[model samples]
Target chain A: MIELLLTPLHYEYMIKAIVVSGVIGGVCGLLSCFVTLKGWSLMGDALSHAIVPGVAVAYLVGLPFALGAFASGLLAAVVMGVVKSKTRIREDAVIGIVFTTFFAAGVLMISLFPSNISLKTIVLGNILGIADSDIIQMLAISAVALLVLVLKWKDLLLFAFDPNQAQSIGLNTTRLNLMLLILLAATAVAALQAVGAVLVIAMLVTPGATAYQLTDRFGRMMLLACGMGIVTSMLGAYISYFLNGSTGGCIVCLQTLVFLMAFFFAPKYGIVAARRKARRTTDALLISGDAHPVPALRGL
Target chain B: MSHGSTKLNKNDISSEIDLHVNEVTVAYNNGHVALFDTTFDLGAGTICALVGVNGSGKSTLFKTIMGFLTPTRGSVTIGGKPVQVAQKQNMVAYIPQAEDVDWAFPVSVMDVVLMGRYGYMNFLRIPRATDLEIAIESLRRVNMLDYKERQIGELSGGQKKRVFLARALAQRGRIVLLDEPFSGVDVQTEAAIIELLRELRADEHLILVSTHDLGLVPSFCDQVVIINRTVLAAGPTHDTFTQENLARAFGGTLRDLRIDHTDAPDGTSNEFRVLSDDEEPLIFGHDGRLVDHWHPGIDEEESK
Candidate 1:
């Protein structure tokens, strides 16, 4: 272990992976809170997959992958937003339509290229072999995304609860929504480089959802989720390193474990704990004859 | 079809008008008009009930006032400024329809209320101590202080509505717009909410509530607006709740509002009747001097 740590290549890869994963996880976790709250879990997945055409297009045009992915994701988000806003159709239905169409287009684009870079590998990602440049780019994008979200935190929260209220209060809900959708697309693009489209959804949802079970305060939930993200990333990276498996899969597995634990054990909002508490209270009331008074229980 | 043909009842009116929406028209994207050339005035320091048949533009008018919908024609001015400017010009709080929300989202009563102050706080900053204090105060006002830590998903419909009210109260807005605030509330809770509205109005907060509770207007509200695609009439509750106005507001489908009558101790006449005969029949009551019928039958079911 000591020798491995001292080896220049080993040290560099380990450091690079940890830093990149930690930053990506933390940022995605924070954004995921908003996504989950807005019932946009599938939206995140859709946007993630929607980036392939952009990346493929960028790759074909010899441009940066991030730029390509960002553009494609933005296009998908905008299409989704416009369709949902203008139509009587449900938002999920719109999202389903947009993602499938865009993802299929992306697949066709990749097939047209027929390069050594296969669709399966790029779509799923090769997290273990992430280049130093990719790591740097991922961390930078994540940091920028986090900063933007922090700056617009209040606006975002207001938009999530009641967009009309936000608009009435002089917040341009349309502009703000566009800004958030773009940010979400950008974040999806960044996370895709590290975790692939499939697993990025997990990073965006699981930590925030689990954190939600532990706290009601948005600030607390965001902070707790960031912490959960860091832990999951570190543990997943380590597990993959030792088990000789896919890092992205390992990260999602760890996140699943954390979510399961929180689901059963978290206080206040946890399913199992809440049920137990309700049962205990009912039993206590019944034993104390509090519920025995028929009129009291049934009438005003 | 004649203009000003319907005379408003005059028993339940206050003095000054606070919110005046004149000739406002809103159209959906699909070319359907929700509100057309609507005109109504809500009195200051009074609870004004808005009564109309479903899809008759009641919610559209409320949404317009809240700046959620932009009217295609005419104007909506709160206090004095246009509704668009008034949204930020003064303190304005809105309680949306109960069913318009997704309750499964992860949020708490306190969390929802605290969001009211998000307009006042810096974009990036979290709620401060004062914000929290106001949230708590609002919760206390609505008698939902005990449920502050409870998740929104876990709350009953009435509890959720109260939490929404607390949020509006925390906004500290002088003009409040409420959409179907009593839809799923029990009588006790409804009464409690009405009492809170009374107190708020006493403090000179302009209260505009869009509701199906037409009967409560005689006793609880100072004024009423009868709308059906366009404004039928607007005035004191007693003046506006006439049989003619009710007929126009609900269309001719509502008949002979004299279903049940109770003579008051003060010699005032109170009449209760079915406003509509749908699966959920709308029931309303009038204090004889003024005929008002718009009590939401859905609320009665919740109490049972």
Candidate 2:
């Protein structure tokens, strides 16, 4: 079993793919906690899809792909904010309109100028084709994002939980909000080389959601999310090697599987455990001669 | 109109203006004026109640004071400084309504209270021992010290309010603004919070609370500010909280509660009769005709 697992490490491209996917996964997981808590899961989906136009534009020009990705992602976020504030439209509707338009524009651009860039590679990722420069970029971006999130988790938590209270406490919530958006754009751009646009949202949201079901504390949730990200990415890379399938697809599927496991088996909050707890409590109540069950325990 | 009459005679504390809202007007993006040129001054060592009907801009006024919203016209000063300056110096703290918070957020009671100390620390600075000590002391003040390690989502409604109060207390601010602090709290917790506010007032803190409970205003609050897009009346509770001002602030919705005077059977005194919308008539003993007894039952029902 050990030799079978170690077989994929012999290939240089597989080694590079594993490293890039692991880094991207860790950063996405760290940020997912904030995104899910703030109800910005759709924002992640929107921003990821919105980056395709930027990537196409960068290919047209001589600039790097990540720059185009970041610029377009940031533009999408700013436009969403403006539309929500300036007009009476709801946020989800604005997000849908903006992301779809940008995504359609990107597809049009790709079709109009089809030379070296393939839509297949951009939609699904080209993890095996990742170069040393792409690896450096991913590592650098992930390192900066992780460091900032780790050091300033409390401020972000306060802002996400209650923005008004954060502002009242002298925290410049506008700057904090903008900072989070910028980091989100940067992380999305970094993950683009590994999972591409289509599956990046899963990486950006699943780990945090999975960890949330298992822990009641934010710190533990973050740690557990990061652990899940690395473990799942590594295991998914190995599994994909054996299955001869898409690495991003395998990784996202494994993340979904892990989330499902947490949903049904988490000790404190899982469905099965909660039902068992209810039965135990009812049994205790009956033994104590209190025939009436507690009202709070009825729903469980 | 009768301003500063309810000012307490506390000599030990400095008689500085803690909150001053001067000719402030706040308007929404849709061009609706929420608060129109309202002004008020609160001195140290006083408990002021901000009372208004629905959509009367009580929350708009509080948000402007907290620097969450900017006034279109005028300024708000705290401790003779700008609102932003005071907020940065940790001279102002706010306890928002319990429902405004995300209860399912993954935070302990201690973590929530420790957020109060963030204003004192620099960027990226962790809470130190002194901050933890202050947080624990604040939780103790609100009688939530035992639940400090529990997740906030596990708390009851009253406990949640107490936790927010403890967060406000941990700020150690000279001026505390509580928005509907009694909304979902039980009677026991309400009494405990009132007692705690009294203690804070005695310690020379300026406590400005917005509440729908007008009955508690005359007895619990030292001053009252009645607002309806503007300041209709603001002064000592006994002097400013009259029938005409309340009727004007509450509009025709308040006129449904009719109070009349009838001669007692003994023929020596007049008994006041309160006829509510759907409830039975209640009688109160009085010697003469009470011109206008404003029962807040209708207001409570309207809020619900």
Candidate 3:
């Protein structure tokens, strides 16, 4: 297996596929921490799917896909923001309505376009046969997006956790909120080219959510999420390489599998770990004839 | 952390009071008045309780003070200046209602409170040791020192309030506005928080709280401002808490809440009425009408 892995380095396309997918997955994994932490997983999904119309429009106008995706994602964010503030409806409802309508509009536009352009490839992703330019675009866009996110991490965290306190403390919460939405849009757009709309939600949510189950600390969760994304992306790619299966689907499947494992087996808060600890304590109490209660933790 | 210091020159301290609302009227987008023609002077080193019954515009008053709402008729002044000053952004610290937060956000209590120091920290800089120290000190003030690393989502209602208070404390502002800080708090936690507020007062911080707990007025407040779409009363508690004043401000609806009198330390009765029965019959004005064959004076005899 090691020899085969090393031998694949000679094939530039294979190397490109691995290196590009790893970079996208790793960065998105870090971004996922913010998404899951903010409880905006659904919003991320909405933004990711919402990129379709932009891509379609770009195709119609013969523009770069990233430009279209970014524009449409930004538009969706604006719509979501307006609906959230101006109306009494919950944010999820607004996002749902916006994404669904735009997605339908995208599908319609794609059907109306010339048949030879192959819009279905965009839905299923172009990971296996990814071209040099596609790889370059993914790397360039994802790199810039990730850099911006890291630089503004504190501001975004503040706005996400408490906008009122953020405002009162002299932070420009309005600007930060808009910046966060733009970052989300950019991340979605960058990831869109590799995993496509159907599977980007998992890439955005599962790794971060699984990391959340394992730790309560923000920094640790982000690190764990990035690690999870990298691992899942590489393994899924390798598996797809051997089996000729869908790389994006395989990646999402691996992410789902990791989430399930963390959901049940995470030592800190997982269901299985908690239950096992409870049982152990119950047995100890039965044997000792008294309960040694755990002291409550302090210092948030 | 040092914004709380006396290093601020008298002029600097005086100059920072720039939150002003002039003839501001705040109505819902639908045009229902939330605050109307409200005006008040808020200075440093005082805790003003914006007290009233539900929908008496206590929150509206706070919102107006924070510039969240534009008062329709009168304007509020901070430091004898308008609210548009550039230096005024970090001058005020506001603690909103507990329910306003989305508790499920994945962040440590420390992370939430440390955000208060964002005003002082450079925009692109990561939180420094100073920020951490300030955040921890703020948490310590609120007795949340132990939960610094705990996720905010795991906190109880009172704990959540304390966390937010810690956040405001970290802001190190001279004026702190807390909305319903004692709501859902146990007696012990409430006492702790009241002690913390008193300490803040000693630092010459101005604390404004919107609260329904009229019982706490005489003890916790240096001054009480009763608001009901407008200023009902504003003065020291003894003068402002009179039954006639309460009746006027609360619209006579809360009169049935029995007031119990207890003696003072000097053997003269303290004269302040404690809550006797939360639910009791209202004493009616003289109508000269008989009820169940008993007159107003005769009812005392008939019951015996």
Candidate 4:
């Protein structure tokens, strides 16, 4: 088993794919905590899908895809905000309408202007065939995004927990929302390079959700999510070397497995554990209402 | 933690604190006036109850005071500063309703309390030793230090409210706004909260507690501001919180009854009147004085 794992590390391309995937995965995971906390899972999906047109436009114009993708992602967010505000449409409906329209426009552009960029690579991702420039762009974006998130985590956490209180304390909540939106767009663009659009949402949501099931602290959530992201990404790449499968598919499958495991078997928050706890508490011997319904966690 | 020197005295904090709402008027975008010519002046060291019927602009008044809404006609000043200025200076704290909080958030009780010190922190908002001490002390004040490390989601409803009150205490703001703190809490929790408010008043914190619980209004609050789209009356609780003003504020919504006791043993001929507006009834004794404690009359009769 050791020799089999070592065999893939000998190849430069495999090393490249694994390294890039791990770092980008960690960034996506870090961002996933905030995204999930703010209930912006659908927004992640919307932003990632909406970037397709911008990516295609960048490819056609011979410019960096990040710029075009970031712009269009921002536009999608803004359009959703505007539509939700301007009309009486609910936020989820606005998100659905905006993303589908942008995605369709991207498809039309791809069909009209076919080139070296394959629709499959853009949509489903071709992590194994990524280029050198793409690696630098992804790393730079991920590093900066990571720095910002780590530095401002407390404010972000407070804002996510209670916007009214956050606002009352002189925190610029509007600016904070704008900053999170920008970060969301940037992360979506970076993640698009690895898992493509459809799978990026999972990369942006699953790790944090899984972490949420396992821990009761935001700091722990952040660490567990990032660790889950890195391990799964690299392990998925390694497994793909042996199975000769789609790396994105393998990574998503692995993440799904972890989430299901947490969902059903995590000690405190797992469904099975919860049911067991319910069974045990049938008569609730202590009878103190303040006894903490779940097992007591003293906290960190 | 060197709370040694930086800690501010209650006198220093409260002496300069004053909240003045001038002839403020708020109107919605569709040309509906929610509040008109609402004016009230409140100083420190008093607990004020903002009493009003639903849709009588209580929420609008709160929003205006919190700087969430701007009044069309007048201005609100806090301690000689504008509402926004006071907010930026961290002179205001809010203990919001339960519905506004995300209970499942992955923050510990300590973590939530620590957020109260954000304005005093550095750019990164890292809690220092002093902040930690303050947070722990605030939790202790609320009698919740034992549950400091527990996830907020794990707490009971009353515990959750206490944690929030602890956060407001740690905020160290001159003016604290509590929105419907007793809505869904049990009798024990409500009494605990009322006790905490009394302590806050003793500390000279300007507390504005809004509630539909009329019987609770007089127990702890020292001042009262009754409004019906505007200020119907504003003064000391005994002076301003009269039955006449409350009748004007609530109109026909208040349930009133006068049961004259003619067959008393002493034969002094006193009355037993009760008034309710969907909450704890305000009961009057044979001497026609507002009975000071919460007595669920219907339940007491059941027990009898």
Candidate 2 local lDDT, A1-300, one digit each (tens): 988878899999898888778878988998999988998889989999999999899888957788888889989988888988988899899999999999999989999998466787788887878767767877888999988897888889899998987888788999989888878888888887777789989998999999999998998999999889888887777678899988889999999999999999999999999999999987887887735576666545
Off by over 4 Å in 4: A1-4, A282-300, B1-14, B265-267, B279-304
**Which is better, 2 or 4, measured by lDDT?**
4
List residue ranges in candidate 1 displaced over 4 A.
A1-9, A81-93, A114-120, A278-300, B1-17, B103-106, B125-133, B143-147, B152-160, B252-304
RMSD of each: 8.7, 6.5, 6.6, 6.2
Q: lDDT for every model?
A: 0.77, 0.83, 0.74, 0.87
| Candidate 2 Cα outliers beyond 4 Å, as residue runs | A294-300, B1-17, B255-263, B271-304
**Model 1, A254: alpha-carbon shift in Å?**
0.9
Report lDDT (Cα) of residue B267, candidate 3. 61
Per-residue CA lDDT of candidate 3, range A1-300, in tens?
888766656667656666777788888888887787677788888888889988888878877778888888888888888888899999778989999988888888898885323566667776767656656777888888778877887777667766666665556666886777777777777777667887887888888899989887767887889888888887777667766778888888989999999988999789988899999888986676444454342221
Best-to-worst order by lDDT is 4, 2, 1, 3
The residue-by-residue lDDT of candidate 4 on B106-154, one tens digit each, is 8899999998888778879877888888899999998999999999989
lDDT of 1 at B293: 39
- Any idea what lDDT model 1 has? 0.77
Pairs of residues at least 3 apart in sequence or in different chains that clash in candidate 1: B8-B239, B9-B238, B9-B239, B9-B240, B10-B239, B212-B294, B214-B294, B214-B295, B241-B291
> Which window of 10 residues has the lowest lDDT sum in candidate 1 chain B?
B2-11
lDDT, model 3, position B111: 82
Model 3: residues >4 Å from true position, as ranges? Answer: A5-8, A79-93, A284-300, B1-21, B69-77, B80-89, B102-106, B139-147, B152-160, B252-255, B258-304
What CA RMSD would candidate 4 show? 6.2
